[model samples]
Target: MRLCPAPGGPAPLVVINHGSPARAADRPGLRPAACDSEAVQWFAARGFAVALPLRRGYGASGGDWAEGFGRCPQADFARAGRESARDILAAIEAARRLPAVSGDRPVVVVGQSAGGWGSLALASLNPPGIAAIVNMAGGRGGWAEGAPNTNCRPDLLASAAGEYGRSARVPTLWLYTANDSFFAPAIAQALHAAYTAGGGVAEYRALPGFGEDGHRLFFGRGGSAIWGAELGPWLAARLGRPLASGAAR
Candidate 1:
């Protein structure tokens, strides 16, 4: 995994992307749709650093998608979770090296779909040093459901909760769309219940937009609504300052 550092001086970092965006050298003729570095720029402009990490199979990162990353879609959702756990561990290690990262400052993980699950997995496995998290349609509870699309296992979240969820308290935010094809809006509710039960704090909002749904809007230009609306303020608050509101255009 590689850390894409946001510009500007020292600032706390936010890590995003997992699953599909990850690179698997063995897989050919496949590419992740383009995404926005808005989180990097938006947070950097407001004085926070954004660390974008691509997991094993998606981008330029080199690795055999099968062994190094996670199991295949044919394996089952449980395999996806297993793979995600390894990637999350790598992303955390990489995040610590960012130049804009504040040693004393905690980080905010902003994830969409699979990335969001990784954020929770990280929180459940690591320390509260992570500060905060932002999830856009992160998968939850009904793990068996999204099997076709995600490799995430539902229970890993519980496993993470058992291992690291408690004691590692963090402020979290969620943004979801009701029409999410990858999962029903119920997944969002399950995410809320699970995170809270695991001893994490969270705030969320679910919207309505058919066709444009699915756990994809957390990045790219479409994700700006969540970023400019809730996430921007969240990072600002996490930093003990505030971002100018009306600036989104």
Candidate 2:
């Protein structure tokens, strides 16, 4: 885990989860091997000690892909999400052991794409010190057969979401763009509905389309500008008063 502490004493934490690539080693060449440094910097500027955990079986942390859901035709999305959640929880425990971090401080988990789905699954566990979750274009089993926004079994996805929502107590922010190629607006709404219907506390916001694939919102240079306005108040409410003057932080 790469722990980047902000410019403050024992700042709160933001566990940033990264999305998965098709191949274990293929990190898209553009994105880093671990969490996006740009995102870590953004959270750090806001007085958050960020912990970016490279989950098992991805990148340098090699093993059998623990989060694999099986073949597309009969994927087990629920099992896959739970498998990914285990690594995230382990990362949180690892972060809690750091001397530079306060174990009791509020923790906000922010993830993109597959990472986002993992975050939702983590919500069900309600790990201690976690205040909120921010799911940016979060979903699983997207791009089935290389077709954008076409999941293998969307009902199963919703069912898994409902299962997560049934036991989740953490508040989550669901942010998706109108043109997300990975998860279209309709699918995003269905996921949100399933979550909320199952007693999860979530706030959904569908933003305007970004350049080309909106799935890159959390990875782009100016992505925070679109999410910062809403995130600031949410952070304040969950982590106490906002110490950062800049909204972009």
Candidate 3:
């Protein structure tokens, strides 16, 4: 776990989750985001202490990989997402115990790709202290045959999203790029429709394509400038404070 505290007194906590690699073999090499990473620094600059935790079976936290959703067509996306949420919850609980984190303030959860999927699952539980969520290109069963825009079972994925939405009351922001290779616009729209239809409170935004693949927009260089602009006002509204200027860099 990498905990980067903001300057001054205790601050609201923001737990940022990492995504699952397309290849299972890469899991073992995964590592927690560095304290200086753009995402972590972005939160720190905004007066939010950031915690980046490596889930079980990844990097140095190895044990057993519990988030597998079986094979392509038979994938149990909902179950896998719940498993990932369990770890995210654990990270939140642990971070809350730190003095650098303000216990009185609500937490913000941010995730990309599979981690974003986990955030949605976590929202379904409606865990206390989680004020909001930011999902960047979140989804599963993408690139079934190592091809862009190819999903294993989009219908099932949408169904699973509905299942999560039934109990997810916290407001959420879902951001996707037009050229996201993982979850294209059509799939993203379908997921959003199903989720909102099932009572989820989410605002979905489709941005213009970025770089070669929009799926990497959140982590790519200069990516924060784009997403941060949208997030600033949204987050300020929830936190009831204006964000400090020049924080996105």
Candidate 4:
């Protein structure tokens, strides 16, 4: 994946990952996944330089996907621990070097869907110099069904979220789409449960833009506006003022 840095006090960095591994020029003709488009600009307006990575398999980043996960124990865990961490850490390092970012200020990691998982995993490590985190359409453990979905035990992701929420590590923003067919509402509730239980500070919000499609949020037409409205305030609170966890969607 590519890491695009903004120009200078390790300006607060926001990590954006593409959920699917599809290259920008794939047959799909390059649609935005994860958080891109207006969202990036909005964050940039807040003086935060965003770091977007294309992910390994789908993008130019070279890596062995088959050998890395291959039906092993917590294969997801192993890959996330090894590869995903490296990818995010690399982005963090590069973003910090930008002219806009201050060395003293940590980066803010934001992601959705698959990227959301990585963000949570990265957050668990609590790498040095991280300011805060935002998990949208993300989870703490695995899928409730545990089959068709790639990462079943996603609930485990909350360990890091739980820790962060309960302590002085970083402030967190949690956004969930009510009809998220991707992640059954139950699991979403579990995500909140784990974080709040962990004693962490998470600003939770809901959005209706996804409509009936469920997981295709990033691709949906209204997706951008929905997140922008909800995320905008959360970001404001993090970067400047306190915003609302509102909008019934």
Highest-scoring model, lDDT: 3
User: Given candidate 4, what's the lDDT at residue 64?
Assistant: 41
- Per TM-score, what order, best first? 3, 2, 1, 4
Estimate the lDDT of model 4.
0.57
Ranking by lDDT: 3, 2, 4, 1
Q: List the residue pairs that clash in candidate 2.
A: none
What does candidate 4's lDDT look like per residue over 33-139, in tens digits? Answer: 33345556556556666677655544455554321333333444434533555676787787677675665675678777656656665665678876677777764
Give each prediction's root-mean-square deviation over alpha carbons.
5.0, 2.4, 1.3, 6.0
What is the clash tally of candidate 2?
0
lDDT string, candidate 1, 102-196, tens digits: 75677677766666766655555555467777766765333343343333444454344333345346677778777665656655566576567
What shift in Å separates residue 143 of candidate 2 from its native position after superposition? 1.2
Q: Any runs in candidate 1 off by more than 4 Å, and if so which?
A: 1-8, 21-36, 66-86, 140-168, 244-249
In angstroms, the error of model 4 at 214 is 3.7
Candidate 4's displacement at residue 84, Å, is: 2.1
> Which 10 successive residues of model 2 have the least lDDT summed?
27-36
lDDT of each candidate versus the true structure: 0.56, 0.81, 0.90, 0.57
The TM-score values for the models, in the order shown, are: 0.70, 0.92, 0.96, 0.69
**Candidate 3: lDDT of 214?**
96
Model 4 TM: 0.69
- 19-102 per-residue lDDT for model 2 (tens digits): 887444574232332334566666776777888887777656655678888887677887888888999998888887787677
